[model samples]
Target: METFTEASWYEKKENSIVKCTLCPHNCIIKPGKTGICLVRRNIEGILYAENYAVLSALHFDPVEKKPLYHFYPGQGVLSIGTFGCNLKCSFCQNSDISQNGIRDPERKALTDPQEIINEALDIKGNIGIAYTYNEPVIWFEYVRDVAKVAEKAGLKNVMVSNGFINETPGREMIEFTDAFNIDLKGFTEDFYKKHTSSSLEPVKETIKTIHKAGKHLEITNLVIPTLNDDPVVFEKMVEWIALETGENTVLHLSRYYPHFKVSLPPTEVKKLSGFYKIAKKYLKYVYLGNVADPAMGNNTLCPVCNSEVIVRNGYKTWTSGLDQQGKCKNCGLKIIEHI
Candidate 1:
């Protein structure tokens, strides 16, 4: 039997029930029962993070693989994730790890935050650690612990998340996180409710919170066929990002593939290109993912002079056209984040 870590961001209530404050779910867990995430349980009026020290997946990936275009373009990150998620999305790409809560005793036995830091240090050219693959918010305690250690070692911390966390915990997490890739599933509340079983307002709030904190942030919208691919709705989303998150906000429009339950046809390249045109109107930095055309999505251009500054070929990024200060060498336009 795997033990649990006492969780933060929760409160005790009457009849030994505990209300989880980690995310918008605010699940009121009864004694000996779990929350909506299925990984946080209330035991004698105290909430415990059941997946605290569990590991579902671990690997080293390019920063671009996180789909973060504006933050440390070519760096590699040590990505780690545990099982459990706050939302129930029908088309979850990583459903095996996200939907199923951590249950394997063997996987839990190897849970060590210090080991993560050590492994991160061992990887050559590894810039930092990324809490990714599954929803890192649900693994809050473990992430916080590892991040604290990683910070002291001068390692950057990146979070790949759904951005559904409550303000209190979200603020705390951002303190230690250097960069973030938040999934803005869709533009409408109905789309969110029907497809993800979650609301949209909290996600928007989380984006604003990250932006206001002055952290490196990027947004990914997995364009699904007939679900969130409306040109008008996508225009609204782009406009909102420009107005609220600013024009410099990095946006990635990803091509959705048949996955999990919702097996819609793969997004057409033409449709994604159309969205690219719409987003380009309001955003300074935009890219497409899961597509092969380098000219279409793998290069970054200077907003001032329209010169390609960084060229990326499936994570093998070349910054020859960018100066040491991340400026366009041709016109000296500051277009990327300096390392």
Candidate 2:
């Protein structure tokens, strides 16, 4: 109970009510009532972030698992997440945490930034900390403070997010964050509004803003079987990434499986492969995720010489193709990623 902290990005309203202004939702919360994310509660006109430092899940995972193929290819990162997500996606992978308030009372653990940094440094090849699992933006205060601490500790900060943050907080994140894998969700505003309960323009602005900060930025598009898999929309999205964020942006076209409220079947492997090929036309690096069938899209080929630079099979990444300066060994082309 003492862990609760007054949330930022919200305003105290009349009659002991508070309205959350964090994301575009602009939830008008009543006393003792939580917002859509279920983490921010309005108590006596005070908005509190209940999930601050109350982690529901944590694990040390490969950087690629964040689906960030461009940044630090083979290194491991300490992945951590708290509950509550601003977006209500029907196909949330970590819905167990993203859709709920907190983990079960028995499952909750309190972890401070120092402890996380200590563990990250303790690991031999641990690159940094990656905030994942649920949408990290809703846990804004904790993420911001922890990110600053990690930056000072010489740890690279990574965010696996929905890219739903507003300009103010998003800019602060870029100050310390080294890499990000943002999900564009869907290309159309309707998909964002109807499926995710969010807006598309803010996400697009977030992507542009992140790229301008010179941070390593990658993207993922969860290919729902029918919701967002239309080739026309997908192609447009790839084109937008190329023109707005630059063509070198790495994109991971992940296959969708039935989860949470959505009961649709898994996306067909053929569909995943087809989209991967389409994405290659506009982006320099593209990968297929979720399933490992023929395994054609997991390897990274040089955009110049067409040589397989990095090979991956279920997180086993080989980086011999990249020289000490992060360029292709054969062609010597300067790629944007750190590793």
Candidate 3:
């Protein structure tokens, strides 16, 4: 098993330094050091992905668990994630793995890429592989390798990302990835900088890039109270999604809970409902997440006739309202695809 694969999208600098261009951070690293993403290291002026083919978590998950409602809803996906992340979000949900890389080096298993594809093949009703859990952008080399094999094996690839990637790598991912659920952390630049230790523009660009490519794209905004829950800002964000990624784009307004560095109260269900209404005004498909209320924002209603098209209870989904073509049975409005 190769522990360190030669990383792509990097340049050697003078005095044994290397510049990593995988993400917008473009970290300049000295020999034996790593970039902002702890997974990629600079060894003797050569960049290597330290977490390449390293499996931290692997499971069979509902595609809705990815919170991707429209892309093959109710189907399962072989989900995998390595350690390390590009941005240091204060309220990171998966801070254990994203903030800290493999704690026990000996316990880290370097599984072959084909092994993952084989597992996906063995799963019943699994649509494909989901590069998720931690930031997939940091695990670029391994993801690309697996995606290539998965594609040849007739498996779809879904990326659950922060979308803070550079143009070259982002474009490369679009070629192989079939769907994306990008976390649009916040609407304002200040919020992104203060809470996420990143910026807003690159994520927006990545969303637009994916949308322009005609790929399945969904946006998830974890609404944090007193941070990004301002109605005006939320509306602007919804408008941006509608204008940039078409009104039909799926938007999931997830409730934020106190986690990691932040100890704020859980996002009010009322706030999520308000934002859901704001989003529904612009986007055709809007759903709320992390809230206990199932009836509020769990189902998909047709834009034309307000008829239930897809009903979801947690991960359990039933498309009873749509025919074989994924259109609303009430008014024949095309609600979703790849059903």
Candidate 4:
């Protein structure tokens, strides 16, 4: 059966063609040609999204697995993902699902919003549904619908994305989402084009939109060795986050292993530490992942009092220094707004 797409965010290119203005790519897809996302297809003068209602993977996962630290720590989130991506990240960890056009059989059955909510309720310490594994922005309609259902049920909606969405779609979905973890990728446009086949400006815009919406926002910068591990470039990226986003934003400096087609080598611990120190100058919360360090970069500290606020023992979040209202108990300073 062929899937028909309902596209509202597009421009008529010609009598029998249209252009998808969904992301920065602005793909002018001819009839039967799918966009770079492999989901949005132009079919005889109408643009359609193939992955709508076509769910590929769903599971209950650790919120820390989302790498979302401050928002409902150590809880379970009903993770969800469709297929296709806006970015062609060479080192994509989820490429088997994100980059491929074919569907896998080992996945779960497709359920509606109610089933998703029921599953979230059934899980122990579970928060809500997450639009992840693939680009959630492409599934904007489904996410918005499910998020509405989830929100009414008093469940949170979270998104794990590459942050390569346009302003219109980003703003519409963010109103219903509680928190987000955006992959910053790299600091320069060249790296974005070379590696991800996308641009960096829209992602920066999306990050800013999340911050302005009063939604909890976290950033992940996967440090690829040599390619984007330059100290000067890393320092600039940190400064941008500090100045544009704010000091309180949580930045996860993830270690990169050789994956996908970009086998540049794994990131060094010394370089990760060096970037951490440089990032600390402009940001308050910075944590390292995917590498074994001295546990220095693993735990969260009180920015104001210089005391350990949350002692995280590799996914075991011990909230000792945080009061009921998420304030630093030592100096009574507000560390995280929505802790």
Best by TM-score: 3
Task: Report lDDT (CA) for all predictions.
Answer: 0.89, 0.86, 0.90, 0.84
Every model: Cα RMSD to truth: 1.3, 1.5, 1.2, 1.9
Q: Residue 99, candidate 4: how far off, in angstroms? A: 0.9
Model 2 score (lDDT) = 0.86
Better-scoring candidate (TM-score), 3 or 4: 3
- Full candidate order by lDDT, most accurate first: 3, 1, 2, 4
lDDT of 3 by residue, 1-339 (tens): 246789999998899999999999999999989888888888899998888877788999999999899988778999999899999999999999999976655544545888889889999999999999999999898899999999999999999999999998999999999999999998999999998888999999999999999999999999988988889999999999999999999999998989999999999998888888889899988899998977779898888998888899888999899988888998988878878
- Which pairs clash in the backbone of model 3? none
lDDT winner between candidates 1 and 4: 1
Worst 10 residues of 4 by lDDT: 102-111
Task: Quickly count the clashes in candidate 1.
Answer: 0
Model 1 local distance difference test score: 0.89
* Over 4 Å off, model 2: 105-108
User: Per-residue CA lDDT of candidate 4, range 216-267, in tens?
Assistant: 9999999998778888988998898988889889999999998889878788
Please give the distance, in angstroms, between residue 74's alpha carbon in candidate 4 and its true position after superposition.
Answer: 1.7
Best model number under lDDT: 3
Pairs with steric clashes in candidate 4: none
